[model samples]
Target: MPRRSLADLAPGDLVDDVFLVASKQSRADRQGNLYLTLDLRDPTGNISARVWNVTKSLADSFESGDFLKVRAKAQYAQGITQLVVSHLEAVDPARLGLDPAAFLPKAPVSIAVLTSQLRGFLKSLDDPHLKALCDAFLMDDAFLADFTAVPAGVREHHAYQGGLLEHVVAMMTLASTVGELYPEVNRDLLLVGCFLHDVGKVRELSHQRGFDYTDEGQLVGHLSLGVSMVEEKLPLVQRLLGEPFPPETLLRIKHMILSHHGTLEFGSPKLPMTPEAVALHHLDALDSKLHAALREIRDDPDTASRWTRYDPKRNRRLFKGSAPPAAGEGEEDLD
Candidate 1:
């Protein structure tokens, strides 16, 4: 039988398939009985699950990152679909004939297309120093592979395979279009800033089995890691140009990367201080928040209503009204 993705599941459906264990926890109920809470995932999405009357041995059998063959029934509660697991067992991938690709979500855009667009953006940069800096990353085969595969975030944003690349391309496209509106904004700097702002996510996230933070990612975060990556490549960039790369220009680029989060409270050590930095921050934010909102609407299960379930991340309910009629759909043209 074909595997059913999380999106395919509906209330009252029976489930018997393999899924990745995104998270697992043990908790006691009001009756002081132990139960297991889990987040079971497949490429399309995840569902919260509960295994009541759990045993210590059952809890010890699996972990947050394991793959399990689960027997469950889908149920709706509090406007969300959840799994009530009756049986589950950790399974070895090779033995189950499971393909790893099916378990992880992927970006809508193809990797080749995203990589080509990324290279195109790098080539568009006229500043020799900036071009060299970009080359230090884009030209490296291993780094490019990781950058292409890593997600922009664990869950809040573009949290899927090839998501980092997609996020960068979206930001770069936005930067290009908006930069023309404000001639005062340095286009090359802003474009490069958009590309590099999340480059460190390549290291910050682990995508082998599922998207999760690395030790370094948790300890230092991407902003500082990105700064260190840029600084580490400075000598090579200087050597490529065969001249002293201007310190002031490098500092400005670094500033954009460090401040693209837009505020100190949002994990940026410094707020956007330069025109290009400010533009990059807003462009980045626009792409991320819009993507999050669209994903929420698409994944929302409340099809009976025009409004999506309230999104805690966005702090608002989204309108899910049908698309308006196309230009000549129903009424005859009066003119």
Candidate 2:
């Protein structure tokens, strides 16, 4: 049988396929009967599913990252498609005959190209100490491998394979151009800050099966872990420089990582206090927000409407009007 995509699912369709479990939760309905709620996904998209009257043994048999052989009936409800699962079982990849890559969303850019671009940005840094620090990250074969493969987040932004590298490259490119416009901003520091700001996500998220948080991710969070990663590599950077790295410079870089989230409620322990820190915060925010909005616009199912469904994260709906024509596309001569 041919494969079915989540995007093509509709009301009254029978669903029998392998899907990556994005999330799994046991809940109780009105009568206090136990049920399982799931976010099942393939590369095209995800859908909410519920297995009514689930048993404890069945719930204990699987997790958020496992592949499930699901048999369900689709129903449209609450403006979204959901599945009423009749049968579900954990399944091995080899038995399912499905490629894992086909089940997960990936960055639009290639990992090799993003890595090359990231290295190019790192090489552009002139400060010996900053260059050494970046080298400590970019030159480590193991770290670079993970950094290039991991997602920037589990959700809400660049939440796909190679997303971290894509986000970093975009931020660095924007920082380079924006830094030139603002001479007061420390371009090297800003660029380095972009590289280090989200590096801890390589550990914070588990992408081997699907994007999900690791135990350490939930306990310490990425911001704190990011600062620790920098501290761990500082001695290596100092050794590469053949001299003691400046205490102030190291602290500034760490500050940028710690405060890049921009606000306490948003997870930054400290507000952006330096010019470079402030620039990093805004630039990172711009990239993340734009990516999130674009993902919403692209994934929205209401093609009949001119605006996307309300994005609770962004607190607004995005206009879905066709993009304005370019200069030569359709404009008439102004004679």
Each prediction's TM-score against the native? 0.92, 0.92
- Check candidate 2 and list the clashing pairs: none
What is the per-residue lDDT of model 2 for residues 119-168, given as tens digits with 9 covering 90 to 100?
89999888999999989987788888889888888877889889999999
Off-target runs (Cα >4 Å) in candidate 1 are 43-45, 323-335
TM-score of 2: 0.92
Distance from true location, Cα of 245 in model 1, Å: 2.1
**Number of clashing pairs per prediction, in order:** 0, 0
Best by lDDT: 2
Q: What residue pairs are clashing in model 1?
A: none
Q: Give the alpha carbon lDDT tens digit for every residue of 1-335 in model 1.
A: 65676776789999988889987889999999899999888756788999999988999998876899999999989888899999999998778777766788899899999999989988999999899999988768898889999899987889989999999999999989887899998999999898899988887889888778899999988998998999888888888999988888989989998999898889898999999999999999999999988888887787677889876766889998985678879997798
